[model samples]
Target: MSRVSRDGGQVLPFYAAMMACLLFAALAFVAVGMAGATRSDAQGAADAAALAAAREVRDNAFKGTDLLILTPEEWEEIIRGRRFHTAGACAQANAFAGTNDATAECAFDVPEFTVSVTTNGTVGDSVIPGTENMHARARATALIEPRCFLQPATTPPPPGGGGVVGIECRDGTVIIVNPSDPGPLYKLARKLFVVRLTD
Candidate 1:
Protein backbone atom coordinates (compact mmCIF):
# COMPACT_ATOMS: atom_id res chain seq x y z
CA MET A 1 0.00 0.00 0.00
CA SER A 2 1.22 3.55 -0.82
CA ARG A 3 1.83 5.91 2.09
CA VAL A 4 -0.06 9.26 2.22
CA SER A 5 2.12 12.26 1.23
CA ARG A 6 2.77 14.94 3.87
CA ASP A 7 3.12 17.62 1.12
CA GLY A 8 -0.68 17.78 0.71
CA GLY A 9 -0.85 20.54 3.32
CA GLN A 10 0.94 22.99 0.97
CA VAL A 11 -2.17 23.30 -1.23
CA LEU A 12 -4.14 24.82 1.64
CA PRO A 13 -1.65 27.75 2.06
CA PHE A 14 -1.70 28.56 -1.65
CA TYR A 15 -5.48 28.85 -1.72
CA ALA A 16 -5.46 31.02 1.39
CA ALA A 17 -2.93 33.43 -0.11
CA MET A 18 -4.98 33.85 -3.25
CA MET A 19 -8.07 34.63 -1.19
CA ALA A 20 -6.26 37.26 0.79
CA CYS A 21 -5.04 39.04 -2.31
CA LEU A 22 -8.54 39.16 -3.77
CA LEU A 23 -9.98 40.56 -0.57
CA PHE A 24 -7.39 43.31 -0.45
CA ALA A 25 -8.06 44.27 -4.04
CA ALA A 26 -11.79 44.54 -3.39
CA LEU A 27 -11.23 46.79 -0.42
CA ALA A 28 -8.96 49.06 -2.44
CA PHE A 29 -11.53 49.47 -5.16
CA VAL A 30 -14.21 50.36 -2.65
CA ALA A 31 -12.00 52.98 -1.04
CA VAL A 32 -11.30 54.64 -4.38
CA GLY A 33 -14.99 54.76 -5.22
CA MET A 34 -15.84 56.35 -1.88
CA ALA A 35 -13.26 59.09 -2.34
CA GLY A 36 -14.60 59.89 -5.78
CA ALA A 37 -18.14 60.13 -4.50
CA THR A 38 -17.18 62.50 -1.70
CA ARG A 39 -15.44 64.81 -4.15
CA SER A 40 -18.51 64.95 -6.36
CA ASP A 41 -20.76 65.83 -3.46
CA ALA A 42 -18.51 68.63 -2.32
CA GLN A 43 -18.38 70.12 -5.81
CA GLY A 44 -22.15 70.17 -6.09
CA ALA A 45 -22.55 71.87 -2.72
CA ALA A 46 -19.99 74.53 -3.60
CA ASP A 47 -21.64 75.33 -6.92
CA ALA A 48 -25.06 75.61 -5.31
CA ALA A 49 -23.84 77.93 -2.60
CA ALA A 50 -22.08 80.18 -5.10
CA LEU A 51 -25.11 80.44 -7.36
CA ALA A 52 -27.44 81.16 -4.48
CA ALA A 53 -25.22 83.92 -3.20
CA ALA A 54 -25.10 85.45 -6.66
CA ARG A 55 -28.86 85.31 -6.98
CA GLU A 56 -29.25 87.14 -3.69
CA VAL A 57 -26.89 89.85 -4.87
CA ARG A 58 -28.76 90.20 -8.10
CA ASP A 59 -32.21 90.22 -6.62
CA ASN A 60 -31.51 92.39 -3.59
CA ALA A 61 -28.11 94.05 -3.64
CA PHE A 62 -27.00 95.25 -7.07
CA LYS A 63 -29.47 97.83 -8.22
CA GLY A 64 -28.41 100.80 -10.32
CA THR A 65 -24.90 100.35 -9.06
CA ASP A 66 -21.58 99.32 -10.60
CA LEU A 67 -20.89 96.94 -7.73
CA LEU A 68 -22.70 95.18 -4.96
CA ILE A 69 -22.67 97.19 -1.75
CA LEU A 70 -22.93 95.16 1.45
CA THR A 71 -21.52 96.01 4.81
CA PRO A 72 -19.30 93.44 6.48
CA GLU A 73 -21.97 92.54 8.99
CA GLU A 74 -24.65 92.41 6.34
CA TRP A 75 -22.57 90.16 4.11
CA GLU A 76 -21.92 87.81 6.97
CA GLU A 77 -25.57 87.70 7.85
CA ILE A 78 -26.60 86.85 4.32
CA ILE A 79 -23.91 84.20 3.88
CA ARG A 80 -24.44 82.64 7.28
CA GLY A 81 -28.14 82.19 6.66
CA ARG A 82 -27.26 80.50 3.40
CA ARG A 83 -25.01 78.11 5.38
CA PHE A 84 -21.80 79.87 4.33
CA HIS A 85 -19.39 81.28 6.86
CA THR A 86 -18.29 84.75 5.72
CA ALA A 87 -14.96 86.42 6.48
CA GLY A 88 -15.02 90.05 5.25
CA ALA A 89 -15.83 92.30 2.28
CA CYS A 90 -13.25 93.79 -0.10
CA ALA A 91 -13.01 95.71 -3.39
CA GLN A 92 -11.55 93.93 -6.42
CA ALA A 93 -9.41 96.35 -8.43
CA ASN A 94 -7.55 94.20 -10.91
CA ALA A 95 -7.73 94.56 -14.66
CA PHE A 96 -8.51 91.13 -16.10
CA ALA A 97 -10.57 89.87 -18.98
CA GLY A 98 -14.26 89.46 -18.06
CA THR A 99 -13.46 90.75 -14.59
CA ASN A 100 -11.94 94.12 -15.46
CA ASP A 101 -15.31 95.71 -14.87
CA ALA A 102 -15.93 96.57 -11.22
CA THR A 103 -19.27 94.85 -11.41
CA ALA A 104 -17.58 91.62 -12.47
CA GLU A 105 -15.62 91.30 -9.25
CA CYS A 106 -16.64 90.98 -5.61
CA ALA A 107 -14.69 92.10 -2.59
CA PHE A 108 -14.50 90.07 0.58
CA ASP A 109 -12.69 91.10 3.75
CA VAL A 110 -13.75 88.13 5.82
CA PRO A 111 -11.82 84.88 6.05
CA GLU A 112 -14.58 82.32 5.88
CA PHE A 113 -17.10 83.63 3.34
CA THR A 114 -14.40 85.03 1.13
CA VAL A 115 -12.64 81.69 0.83
CA SER A 116 -13.13 79.19 -1.95
CA VAL A 117 -14.39 75.67 -1.34
CA THR A 118 -12.04 73.32 -3.10
CA THR A 119 -12.65 69.80 -4.38
CA ASN A 120 -10.09 68.65 -1.84
CA GLY A 121 -12.62 69.63 0.87
CA THR A 122 -10.84 72.71 2.16
CA VAL A 123 -12.61 76.08 2.51
CA GLY A 124 -11.36 79.66 2.75
CA ASP A 125 -8.85 79.95 -0.06
CA SER A 126 -8.91 83.17 -2.04
CA VAL A 127 -9.57 83.02 -5.75
CA ILE A 128 -7.36 86.04 -6.36
CA PRO A 129 -3.89 85.50 -7.72
CA GLY A 130 -1.73 87.03 -4.99
CA THR A 131 -4.35 86.52 -2.28
CA GLU A 132 -4.92 82.82 -2.83
CA ASN A 133 -4.59 81.96 0.83
CA MET A 134 -6.29 85.11 2.06
CA HIS A 135 -10.00 84.58 1.39
CA ALA A 136 -12.85 82.67 -0.25
CA ARG A 137 -15.28 83.93 -2.87
CA ALA A 138 -18.82 83.36 -4.08
CA ARG A 139 -20.27 85.65 -6.72
CA ALA A 140 -23.89 86.47 -7.55
CA THR A 141 -25.29 89.22 -9.76
CA ALA A 142 -28.54 90.17 -11.49
CA LEU A 143 -30.55 93.15 -12.70
CA ILE A 144 -32.54 95.34 -10.31
CA GLU A 145 -35.90 94.46 -8.89
CA PRO A 146 -38.90 96.05 -10.59
CA ARG A 147 -40.55 99.24 -9.29
CA CYS A 148 -44.06 99.96 -8.07
CA PHE A 149 -45.46 103.09 -6.38
CA LEU A 150 -47.53 103.35 -3.24
CA GLN A 151 -51.08 104.56 -3.68
CA PRO A 152 -51.74 108.29 -3.32
CA ALA A 153 -53.00 109.56 0.05
CA THR A 154 -56.74 109.16 0.50
CA THR A 155 -57.48 110.90 3.83
CA PRO A 156 -60.37 113.38 3.71
CA PRO A 157 -59.47 117.06 3.85
CA PRO A 158 -59.95 118.91 7.16
CA PRO A 159 -63.29 120.69 7.80
CA GLY A 160 -64.90 120.84 4.32
CA GLY A 161 -63.08 117.56 3.43
CA GLY A 162 -62.65 118.74 -0.13
CA GLY A 163 -60.28 115.96 -1.02
CA VAL A 164 -58.44 113.00 0.46
CA VAL A 165 -55.14 113.65 2.25
CA GLY A 166 -52.70 111.63 4.37
CA ILE A 167 -54.73 108.46 3.78
CA GLU A 168 -51.94 105.92 3.30
CA CYS A 169 -52.81 102.79 1.31
CA ARG A 170 -50.76 99.90 0.00
CA ASP A 171 -50.42 99.85 -3.75
CA GLY A 172 -51.90 96.79 -5.46
CA THR A 173 -49.32 97.16 -8.17
CA VAL A 174 -46.32 94.80 -8.00
CA ILE A 175 -43.38 96.91 -8.99
CA ILE A 176 -40.70 94.99 -10.86
CA VAL A 177 -37.65 97.13 -10.47
CA ASN A 178 -34.84 96.77 -12.94
CA PRO A 179 -32.07 94.63 -11.50
CA SER A 180 -29.73 97.54 -12.08
CA ASP A 181 -31.54 100.24 -10.09
CA PRO A 182 -33.11 98.70 -7.02
CA GLY A 183 -33.10 102.08 -5.25
CA PRO A 184 -33.02 102.80 -1.53
CA LEU A 185 -35.61 100.23 -0.58
CA TYR A 186 -33.32 97.47 -1.81
CA LYS A 187 -31.06 97.69 1.19
CA LEU A 188 -33.88 97.63 3.70
CA ALA A 189 -35.85 94.88 2.02
CA ARG A 190 -32.81 92.67 1.49
CA LYS A 191 -32.25 92.45 5.20
CA LEU A 192 -35.54 90.61 5.60
CA PHE A 193 -34.92 88.11 2.82
CA VAL A 194 -33.17 84.75 3.16
CA VAL A 195 -31.69 82.35 0.66
CA ARG A 196 -32.70 78.70 0.33
CA LEU A 197 -31.09 75.85 -1.65
CA THR A 198 -32.80 73.09 -3.58
CA ASP A 199 -31.74 69.66 -4.78
Candidate 2:
Protein backbone atom coordinates (compact mmCIF):
# COMPACT_ATOMS: atom_id res chain seq x y z
CA MET A 1 0.00 0.00 0.00
CA SER A 2 1.18 3.54 -0.78
CA ARG A 3 2.28 5.57 2.23
CA VAL A 4 -0.56 8.06 1.93
CA SER A 5 -1.18 10.51 4.82
CA ARG A 6 -4.35 9.54 6.58
CA ASP A 7 -3.93 11.96 9.52
CA GLY A 8 -6.66 14.40 8.39
CA GLY A 9 -9.17 11.70 7.56
CA GLN A 10 -8.33 9.84 10.75
CA VAL A 11 -9.26 12.87 12.87
CA LEU A 12 -12.48 13.54 10.95
CA PRO A 13 -14.55 10.86 12.65
CA PHE A 14 -13.14 11.77 16.05
CA TYR A 15 -13.90 15.46 15.52
CA ALA A 16 -17.40 14.67 14.23
CA ALA A 17 -18.16 12.59 17.29
CA MET A 18 -16.86 15.32 19.60
CA MET A 19 -18.97 17.92 17.80
CA ALA A 20 -22.06 15.76 18.16
CA CYS A 21 -21.40 15.41 21.89
CA LEU A 22 -20.91 19.14 22.27
CA LEU A 23 -24.15 19.79 20.43
CA PHE A 24 -25.97 17.42 22.72
CA ALA A 25 -24.42 19.01 25.76
CA ALA A 26 -25.57 22.43 24.65
CA LEU A 27 -29.04 21.06 24.03
CA ALA A 28 -29.13 19.48 27.45
CA PHE A 29 -28.12 22.71 29.08
CA VAL A 30 -30.91 24.54 27.26
CA ALA A 31 -33.45 21.94 28.25
CA VAL A 32 -32.48 22.13 31.91
CA GLY A 33 -32.70 25.91 31.82
CA MET A 34 -36.15 25.78 30.26
CA ALA A 35 -37.34 23.23 32.76
CA GLY A 36 -36.12 25.45 35.59
CA ALA A 37 -37.99 28.41 34.18
CA THR A 38 -41.12 26.35 33.89
CA ARG A 39 -40.81 25.22 37.48
CA SER A 40 -40.35 28.76 38.68
CA ASP A 41 -43.42 29.85 36.78
CA ALA A 42 -45.42 27.10 38.31
CA GLN A 43 -44.27 28.01 41.78
CA GLY A 44 -45.32 31.59 41.26
CA ALA A 45 -48.74 30.50 40.19
CA ALA A 46 -49.19 28.20 43.14
CA ASP A 47 -48.17 30.91 45.57
CA ALA A 48 -50.58 33.37 44.06
CA ALA A 49 -53.41 30.88 44.14
CA ALA A 50 -52.80 30.06 47.77
CA LEU A 51 -52.77 33.71 48.74
CA ALA A 52 -55.90 34.55 46.79
CA ALA A 53 -57.72 31.62 48.27
CA ALA A 54 -56.76 32.63 51.76
CA ARG A 55 -57.88 36.17 51.11
CA GLU A 56 -61.36 34.85 50.56
CA VAL A 57 -61.44 34.75 54.33
CA ARG A 58 -60.54 38.42 54.44
CA ASP A 59 -63.65 39.65 52.69
CA ASN A 60 -65.83 37.57 54.94
CA ALA A 61 -63.98 38.82 57.96
CA PHE A 62 -64.59 42.37 56.84
CA LYS A 63 -68.25 41.56 56.34
CA GLY A 64 -68.42 40.03 59.77
CA THR A 65 -67.44 43.44 61.11
CA ASP A 66 -70.75 44.87 59.92
CA LEU A 67 -72.24 43.65 63.16
CA LEU A 68 -72.01 46.29 65.88
CA ILE A 69 -70.79 43.87 68.45
CA LEU A 70 -69.16 40.47 68.11
CA THR A 71 -70.65 38.39 70.92
CA PRO A 72 -68.49 36.23 73.10
CA GLU A 73 -69.20 33.22 70.90
CA GLU A 74 -68.76 35.22 67.71
CA TRP A 75 -65.53 36.70 68.99
CA GLU A 76 -64.40 33.23 69.81
CA GLU A 77 -65.07 32.27 66.24
CA ILE A 78 -62.97 35.21 65.02
CA ILE A 79 -60.22 33.99 67.26
CA ARG A 80 -60.65 30.66 65.55
CA GLY A 81 -61.99 32.10 62.37
CA ARG A 82 -63.46 29.87 59.70
CA ARG A 83 -64.59 32.26 57.00
CA PHE A 84 -63.38 30.94 53.69
CA HIS A 85 -65.69 29.08 51.34
CA THR A 86 -64.18 26.25 49.34
CA ALA A 87 -65.88 27.00 46.05
CA GLY A 88 -65.54 30.76 46.19
CA ALA A 89 -61.98 30.62 47.36
CA CYS A 90 -61.09 28.11 44.68
CA ALA A 91 -62.63 30.38 42.12
CA GLN A 92 -60.27 33.12 43.22
CA ALA A 93 -57.39 30.70 42.97
CA ASN A 94 -58.38 29.59 39.48
CA ALA A 95 -58.61 33.15 38.31
CA PHE A 96 -55.17 33.91 39.70
CA ALA A 97 -53.72 30.82 38.02
CA GLY A 98 -55.26 31.78 34.70
CA THR A 99 -53.53 35.12 34.94
CA ASN A 100 -50.20 33.29 35.17
CA ASP A 101 -51.01 30.93 32.31
CA ALA A 102 -51.41 28.02 34.68
CA THR A 103 -54.27 25.91 35.96
CA ALA A 104 -54.84 25.47 39.66
CA GLU A 105 -55.94 22.47 41.66
CA CYS A 106 -56.92 24.00 44.95
CA ALA A 107 -57.80 22.57 48.32
CA PHE A 108 -58.98 24.49 51.32
CA ASP A 109 -58.33 23.26 54.82
CA VAL A 110 -61.31 24.81 56.45
CA PRO A 111 -61.18 26.15 60.03
CA GLU A 112 -57.44 26.29 59.65
CA PHE A 113 -57.87 28.82 56.86
CA THR A 114 -55.15 27.22 54.87
CA VAL A 115 -55.31 27.00 51.12
CA SER A 116 -53.17 24.58 49.15
CA VAL A 117 -52.88 25.02 45.45
CA THR A 118 -51.13 22.98 42.81
CA THR A 119 -50.36 24.66 39.56
CA ASN A 120 -50.04 22.79 36.27
CA GLY A 121 -48.54 24.61 33.36
CA THR A 122 -46.30 22.98 30.82
CA VAL A 123 -43.08 24.48 29.67
CA GLY A 124 -43.45 24.58 25.94
CA ASP A 125 -41.05 23.80 23.05
CA SER A 126 -38.27 22.08 24.88
CA VAL A 127 -35.35 21.17 22.62
CA ILE A 128 -34.92 17.73 24.11
CA PRO A 129 -37.32 15.04 23.00
CA GLY A 130 -40.05 13.97 25.45
CA THR A 131 -39.39 17.00 27.62
CA GLU A 132 -42.20 18.86 25.93
CA ASN A 133 -44.63 16.78 27.90
CA MET A 134 -43.10 17.92 31.16
CA HIS A 135 -45.77 19.51 33.20
CA ALA A 136 -44.42 21.96 35.72
CA ARG A 137 -46.29 21.74 38.97
CA ALA A 138 -45.88 23.24 42.39
CA ARG A 139 -47.81 23.31 45.63
CA ALA A 140 -48.16 26.24 47.98
CA THR A 141 -50.08 26.68 51.20
CA ALA A 142 -51.26 29.97 52.71
CA LEU A 143 -52.69 30.80 56.09
CA ILE A 144 -54.99 33.54 57.27
CA GLU A 145 -54.12 34.79 60.75
CA PRO A 146 -56.15 37.34 62.62
CA ARG A 147 -54.48 40.50 63.87
CA CYS A 148 -56.81 41.28 66.74
CA PHE A 149 -56.19 39.77 70.13
CA LEU A 150 -58.26 40.79 73.11
CA GLN A 151 -58.38 39.55 76.68
CA PRO A 152 -61.95 39.18 77.82
CA ALA A 153 -63.15 41.24 80.74
CA THR A 154 -62.28 39.44 83.93
CA THR A 155 -64.83 41.13 86.20
CA PRO A 156 -68.45 41.70 85.26
CA PRO A 157 -69.80 44.97 86.67
CA PRO A 158 -73.28 45.06 88.25
CA PRO A 159 -76.52 46.08 86.37
CA GLY A 160 -75.73 46.24 82.62
CA GLY A 161 -73.01 43.66 83.19
CA GLY A 162 -69.99 44.92 81.24
CA GLY A 163 -68.50 45.88 77.92
CA VAL A 164 -65.06 45.77 76.31
CA VAL A 165 -62.72 48.33 77.85
CA GLY A 166 -60.03 48.12 75.21
CA ILE A 167 -57.37 45.88 73.83
CA GLU A 168 -54.26 46.87 75.69
CA CYS A 169 -50.67 46.99 74.40
CA ARG A 170 -50.56 46.65 70.65
CA ASP A 171 -46.78 46.51 70.19
CA GLY A 172 -46.51 48.09 73.66
CA THR A 173 -48.86 50.84 72.61
CA VAL A 174 -51.80 50.51 74.99
CA ILE A 175 -54.91 50.86 72.81
CA ILE A 176 -56.86 52.45 75.64
CA VAL A 177 -60.45 53.71 75.69
CA ASN A 178 -63.78 52.09 76.33
CA PRO A 179 -66.05 50.61 73.67
CA SER A 180 -67.01 54.12 72.66
CA ASP A 181 -64.39 54.26 69.89
CA PRO A 182 -66.07 53.83 66.51
CA GLY A 183 -63.08 52.02 65.08
CA PRO A 184 -62.29 49.75 68.02
CA LEU A 185 -65.48 47.71 67.94
CA TYR A 186 -65.30 47.74 64.16
CA LYS A 187 -61.69 46.65 64.36
CA LEU A 188 -62.60 43.92 66.83
CA ALA A 189 -65.42 42.35 64.86
CA ARG A 190 -64.28 42.92 61.29
CA LYS A 191 -60.59 42.64 61.84
CA LEU A 192 -58.41 42.55 58.76
CA PHE A 193 -56.21 39.49 58.63
CA VAL A 194 -52.82 38.78 57.21
CA VAL A 195 -52.08 36.07 54.67
CA ARG A 196 -48.81 34.25 54.44
CA LEU A 197 -47.57 31.27 52.49
CA THR A 198 -46.23 28.45 54.63
CA ASP A 199 -45.01 26.28 51.81
Candidate 3:
Protein backbone atom coordinates (compact mmCIF):
# COMPACT_ATOMS: atom_id res chain seq x y z
CA MET A 1 0.00 0.00 0.00
CA SER A 2 2.93 2.37 0.72
CA ARG A 3 4.40 1.75 -2.75
CA VAL A 4 1.04 2.34 -4.40
CA SER A 5 0.63 5.67 -2.60
CA ARG A 6 4.08 6.88 -3.71
CA ASP A 7 3.30 6.03 -7.34
CA GLY A 8 -0.04 7.82 -7.12
CA GLY A 9 1.70 10.92 -5.76
CA GLN A 10 4.13 10.96 -8.72
CA VAL A 11 1.25 10.61 -11.18
CA LEU A 12 -0.46 13.69 -9.72
CA PRO A 13 2.52 15.96 -10.45
CA PHE A 14 2.83 14.59 -13.98
CA TYR A 15 -0.85 15.27 -14.63
CA ALA A 16 -0.55 18.78 -13.25
CA ALA A 17 2.46 19.50 -15.46
CA MET A 18 0.60 18.24 -18.54
CA MET A 19 -2.37 20.46 -17.77
CA ALA A 20 -0.15 23.51 -17.48
CA CYS A 21 1.44 22.82 -20.87
CA LEU A 22 -1.97 22.49 -22.48
CA LEU A 23 -3.11 25.75 -20.98
CA PHE A 24 -0.05 27.55 -22.30
CA ALA A 25 -0.61 26.18 -25.76
CA ALA A 26 -4.22 27.29 -25.75
CA LEU A 27 -3.24 30.82 -24.72
CA ALA A 28 -0.65 30.96 -27.46
CA PHE A 29 -3.22 29.99 -30.09
CA VAL A 30 -5.58 32.67 -28.88
CA ALA A 31 -2.82 35.24 -29.11
CA VAL A 32 -2.04 34.32 -32.71
CA GLY A 33 -5.72 34.49 -33.64
CA MET A 34 -6.08 37.97 -32.17
CA ALA A 35 -2.99 39.16 -34.02
CA GLY A 36 -4.41 37.91 -37.29
CA ALA A 37 -7.67 39.70 -36.62
CA THR A 38 -5.89 42.96 -35.88
CA ARG A 39 -3.85 42.66 -39.06
CA SER A 40 -6.94 42.11 -41.16
CA ASP A 41 -8.60 45.13 -39.68
CA ALA A 42 -5.59 47.31 -40.32
CA GLN A 43 -5.42 46.20 -43.94
CA GLY A 44 -9.09 47.05 -44.44
CA ALA A 45 -8.49 50.53 -43.12
CA ALA A 46 -5.53 51.01 -45.45
CA ASP A 47 -7.54 49.91 -48.43
CA ALA A 48 -10.30 52.36 -47.68
CA ALA A 49 -7.87 55.26 -47.37
CA ALA A 50 -6.09 54.38 -50.59
CA LEU A 51 -9.30 54.16 -52.62
CA ALA A 52 -10.56 57.47 -51.29
CA ALA A 53 -7.31 59.21 -52.12
CA ALA A 54 -7.36 57.87 -55.67
CA ARG A 55 -10.92 59.01 -56.24
CA GLU A 56 -10.17 62.50 -54.98
CA VAL A 57 -7.24 62.82 -57.34
CA ARG A 58 -9.31 61.61 -60.26
CA ASP A 59 -12.21 63.93 -59.51
CA ASN A 60 -9.94 66.93 -59.15
CA ALA A 61 -8.21 66.19 -62.43
CA PHE A 62 -11.56 65.93 -64.19
CA LYS A 63 -12.44 69.45 -63.11
CA GLY A 64 -10.44 71.06 -65.96
CA THR A 65 -6.98 71.98 -67.32
CA ASP A 66 -5.72 73.17 -63.91
CA LEU A 67 -3.46 70.18 -63.74
CA LEU A 68 -1.70 71.36 -66.89
CA ILE A 69 -1.28 74.97 -65.76
CA LEU A 70 -0.20 74.43 -62.14
CA THR A 71 3.56 74.78 -61.48
CA PRO A 72 5.48 71.88 -59.98
CA GLU A 73 5.23 73.34 -56.45
CA GLU A 74 1.62 74.26 -56.95
CA TRP A 75 0.86 70.81 -58.31
CA GLU A 76 2.56 69.13 -55.40
CA GLU A 77 0.65 71.28 -52.95
CA ILE A 78 -2.62 70.54 -54.66
CA ILE A 79 -1.92 66.83 -54.74
CA ARG A 80 -0.78 66.73 -51.14
CA GLY A 81 -3.74 68.71 -49.93
CA ARG A 82 -6.14 66.48 -51.78
CA ARG A 83 -4.44 63.29 -50.61
CA PHE A 84 -4.17 64.29 -46.95
CA HIS A 85 -7.69 65.64 -46.74
CA THR A 86 -9.15 62.51 -48.21
CA ALA A 87 -6.95 60.21 -46.14
CA GLY A 88 -7.51 62.10 -42.90
CA ALA A 89 -11.25 62.19 -43.31
CA CYS A 90 -11.41 58.49 -44.08
CA ALA A 91 -9.03 57.52 -41.30
CA GLN A 92 -10.98 59.57 -38.79
CA ALA A 93 -14.09 57.64 -39.70
CA ASN A 94 -12.34 54.30 -39.20
CA ALA A 95 -11.94 52.86 -35.70
CA PHE A 96 -8.35 51.64 -36.15
CA ALA A 97 -6.82 54.92 -37.30
CA GLY A 98 -4.95 56.32 -34.30
CA THR A 99 -4.70 53.22 -32.10
CA ASN A 100 -2.07 51.23 -33.96
CA ASP A 101 1.72 51.58 -33.79
CA ALA A 102 3.25 55.01 -34.25
CA THR A 103 4.60 54.34 -37.72
CA ALA A 104 1.27 52.91 -38.79
CA GLU A 105 -0.60 55.92 -37.50
CA CYS A 106 1.71 58.33 -39.33
CA ALA A 107 1.11 56.61 -42.63
CA PHE A 108 -2.52 55.89 -41.89
CA ASP A 109 -1.26 52.30 -41.75
CA VAL A 110 -0.31 52.61 -45.43
CA PRO A 111 3.44 52.14 -45.49
CA GLU A 112 3.94 52.95 -49.17
CA PHE A 113 1.50 54.81 -51.41
CA THR A 114 1.64 57.02 -54.54
CA VAL A 115 -0.56 59.51 -56.43
CA SER A 116 0.39 60.65 -59.96
CA VAL A 117 -1.11 62.84 -62.72
CA THR A 118 -0.02 63.13 -66.38
CA THR A 119 -1.20 65.79 -68.85
CA ASN A 120 -0.53 65.96 -72.58
CA GLY A 121 -1.37 68.93 -74.86
CA THR A 122 -1.16 68.28 -78.59
CA VAL A 123 -2.13 69.82 -81.95
CA GLY A 124 -4.08 67.55 -84.28
CA ASP A 125 -3.21 67.13 -87.98
CA SER A 126 -6.23 67.60 -90.18
CA VAL A 127 -7.42 69.04 -93.54
CA ILE A 128 -7.96 72.41 -91.90
CA PRO A 129 -4.92 72.27 -89.66
CA GLY A 130 -5.62 75.58 -87.90
CA THR A 131 -8.66 74.09 -86.15
CA GLU A 132 -6.69 71.86 -83.76
CA ASN A 133 -6.71 71.72 -79.96
CA MET A 134 -5.05 70.31 -76.76
CA HIS A 135 -5.36 67.18 -74.64
CA ALA A 136 -4.65 66.09 -71.03
CA ARG A 137 -3.98 62.83 -69.17
CA ALA A 138 -4.02 62.17 -65.44
CA ARG A 139 -3.47 59.17 -63.15
CA ALA A 140 -3.20 58.37 -59.44
CA THR A 141 -1.52 55.52 -57.53
CA ALA A 142 -1.94 54.60 -53.84
CA LEU A 143 0.13 51.79 -52.29
CA ILE A 144 -1.07 50.28 -49.04
CA GLU A 145 1.01 48.37 -46.51
CA PRO A 146 0.07 44.73 -46.23
CA ARG A 147 -1.29 43.48 -42.95
CA CYS A 148 1.34 41.58 -40.94
CA PHE A 149 -0.28 38.22 -40.15
CA LEU A 150 -3.01 37.96 -42.77
CA GLN A 151 -1.09 38.45 -46.02
CA PRO A 152 0.62 35.08 -46.05
CA ALA A 153 -2.59 33.13 -45.64
CA THR A 154 -4.81 35.19 -47.95
CA THR A 155 -2.44 35.87 -50.86
CA PRO A 156 -2.61 33.38 -53.69
CA PRO A 157 0.48 31.29 -54.43
CA PRO A 158 2.87 33.44 -56.45
CA PRO A 159 3.51 34.06 -60.19
CA GLY A 160 2.11 37.64 -60.18
CA GLY A 161 0.94 37.73 -56.64
CA GLY A 162 0.62 41.42 -55.73
CA GLY A 163 -0.58 44.56 -57.57
CA VAL A 164 -2.05 48.06 -57.09
CA VAL A 165 -5.51 49.69 -57.27
CA GLY A 166 -6.41 53.00 -59.03
CA ILE A 167 -8.83 55.13 -61.11
CA GLU A 168 -8.58 57.62 -64.10
CA CYS A 169 -10.42 60.28 -66.18
CA ARG A 170 -9.77 62.45 -69.30
CA ASP A 171 -11.50 65.52 -70.89
CA GLY A 172 -10.89 67.60 -74.05
CA THR A 173 -12.49 69.71 -76.81
CA VAL A 174 -13.01 68.75 -80.47
CA ILE A 175 -13.23 70.83 -83.68
CA ILE A 176 -15.03 69.97 -86.93
CA VAL A 177 -13.86 71.22 -90.31
CA ASN A 178 -13.95 70.37 -94.06
CA PRO A 179 -17.33 69.26 -95.40
CA SER A 180 -15.80 66.46 -97.51
CA ASP A 181 -13.15 65.25 -95.02
CA PRO A 182 -15.28 66.42 -92.08
CA GLY A 183 -12.15 66.23 -89.95
CA PRO A 184 -12.99 66.09 -86.25
CA LEU A 185 -9.80 67.27 -84.52
CA TYR A 186 -9.63 67.12 -80.74
CA LYS A 187 -7.72 65.88 -77.70
CA LEU A 188 -7.16 62.13 -77.44
CA ALA A 189 -6.26 60.57 -74.12
CA ARG A 190 -6.33 57.30 -72.16
CA LYS A 191 -5.72 56.16 -68.62
CA LEU A 192 -4.62 52.86 -67.02
CA PHE A 193 -5.73 52.50 -63.42
CA VAL A 194 -6.07 49.90 -60.66
CA VAL A 195 -7.27 49.45 -57.05
CA ARG A 196 -5.74 46.69 -54.84
CA LEU A 197 -7.55 44.83 -52.10
CA THR A 198 -7.40 41.73 -49.81
CA ASP A 199 -10.21 39.64 -48.37
- Score candidate 2 by lDDT: 0.62
Q: 93-116 in candidate 2: lDDT tens per residue? A: 888988887888777666333333
| Structural similarity to truth (TM-score) of each candidate | 0.35, 0.75, 0.40
- The TM-score of candidate 2 is 0.75
Clashes in candidate 3: how many?
8
> How far out, in Å, is residue 20 in model 3?
1.0
For candidate 1, the 10 contiguous residues with the lowest summed lDDT are 88-97
Alpha carbon lDDT at 106, candidate 3: 24
* Tens-digit per-residue lDDT, 154-174, candidate 1: 222334223322211134423
**How many clashes in each candidate?**
33, 0, 8
The best candidate by lDDT is: 2
Q: Candidate 1: lDDT over CA atoms?
A: 0.35
What RMSD, rounded to one decimal, does every model reach? 14.4, 4.2, 25.0
Lowest summed lDDT window (length 10), candidate 3: 183-192
For candidate 3, list the clashing residue pairs, or say none.
Answer: 113-143, 114-141, 118-137, 165-194, 165-195, 165-196, 166-194, 166-195
